[model samples]
Target: MNKIKIIAKKNQKEIRIDKFIKDNIRQNISRNQIQKLTISGKILVNQHIVKKNYKIKPLDFVEIEISNIPTIRDHLEYNNIIAEKINLDIIHEDEDIIVVNKPAGMVVHPGFGNYQGTLIHGIKYHFQNSNMKNFHLYRSGLVHRLDKDTSGLLVLAKNEYSKQCLSQQFYYRTIQREYRALIWGNILKEKGIITGFIGRDPKNRKRMTIFRNDEYHKGKYSITYYKVLERFQYLTYISCNIKTGKTHQIRTHFKYLGHPLFNDSIYGGNQIFMRKKYSNKNIEFLKTFLKILPRQALHAISISFIHPKNKKCYFHSPIPEDFQMVLQKCRKIFLQ
Candidate 1:
């Protein structure tokens, strides 16, 4: 089952539960289906099953769990993912593999709706033009993937043998990944670990849901170790070290901890959730500061592993200019 969780904001006006669901989903879901869900005890308002006609108030948390909802977007790294002249930041290269600093806004691989101008395209073009013979390219050399908007250090295998070796290292939790993320709130703890089960949200196939209870669908066990790097009055910068590479693990875990990454729209991080009292000037300043970073303020800064060929190598990508600018703005805010 998939789950859709929504929290009514203070800025929102009173609305019926059914209408709220449709408005938030932004997809074609009929009222009859919603009614059926209500009957089946699939809709919850503030942790209680609520009727379709129930009027939702501000600050009420609503959750809708369902079984069938098609994802809105589709992409597959199949025949359509062709080579192109895409810009690539090559950090390190060898006969067996290539390490790249993947920038934000570049898709890792192609899919049904998004097949053009991906990192794989660039890799393929690089291989085709190079004199590296005896190299057999399959699976586009990607052992793992980073989200389109997630800038990070990604290692790609050039041959099948390297791919298999690297894949096992990741599976055995030998690869080390450290990410820097700016999240919404100030966490009480300086350093801690978060553990939970994660699976596809039944209400929305586009997102992942965290399961606190083990019975919630035999979900994959996910763990994240976070250290508070810096603390703003309203926001906290953290370094997340993940043990298991579940999809959206860091982002989802931070949200589950009530500190969604800054500007992460998928997990409701875009909303201006602040703790301190706000003045007109403060709000205006915040609006301007937020505009500095268009995407989620998360960066995969460092990755280390036992290389399939070289034996010992570490890759690092500095924070992008946009993310740096956002940090500058936040620092200015703190100083003021």
Candidate 2:
């Protein structure tokens, strides 16, 4: 284990916690690493946990402890992950990159109890069949990720150079992504931008929530722009373009906006909001729609990014049948 301790003097007052730690500690941990430690309570001020942006005052004591436990990645060996043959919907493939239309219910990569039937396994199998060079099972070739239930276009690099270039594009926010989703309530705004700080829910680690006003210091800044595509009596279809890609960002932001994604199990969208009056027919239709679309009604519809070869690449994925079914049902039933 590695531990760092610092006591702030008058000269260090008001210095941001992350910067303060970086300057005081000999370790070269990054701002993001510091933020994660703070969030997880591994970093503390005056024996009390603080956010990454907390300002250190005079006599404030900061402690950081890094555990030596091996991560899940370290435990994974090449032989541990058997490359079971699985179909990959390869949308675009070239020497440097592969763009795939990932389907709902498919895990992007394996970890913990899930080590098989993942996209990585499928890709490994594909690489084996093609005798691709410079392929490593551990690398997985993934640059970014979509949730297991979120179907969309995902780009995979074929080698280290391509991976580095693509990863930088994502890190710098030079890549463009667009999504389509159906939410539980009709939005009055034709177009709007939602801004808030997003972080893990203190009570539930599995979910994310937005913070505003006094709680703004709790999470990283996130921005989501949405335009209403269609509105029904009980739900609305919208397109979302996110400026920041925080975990569960789209789901959390819309939930904060009072319109959780339809059928989203974790963010209060799985149940009907009975506050609004619903006709018996509409109620029945909603139940049926929920069954039709069991997952969150979100889809990554498009993405655009600069290729490693200095060219622009854009790809669009049509809405899946499940999404189309619910939308069709909305038109036929909710519009009646």
Q: Residue 65 in candidate 1 has what lDDT?
A: 67
Instruction: Give lDDT tens digits, candidate 1, residues 166-201.
Output: 766665567899999999877999999998888777
TM-score of each: 0.74, 0.79
Could you give me the TM-score of model 2 versus the true structure? Answer: 0.79
TM-score (C-alpha, index-matched) for candidate 1: 0.74
The C-alpha stretches of model 1 lying farther than 4 A from their native spots are 1-80, 132-136, 216-218
Q: What are the runs in model 2 whose C-alpha is more than 4 Å off?
A: 1-79, 137-139
What is the RMSD of candidate 2? 5.9
Clashes of each: 11, 0
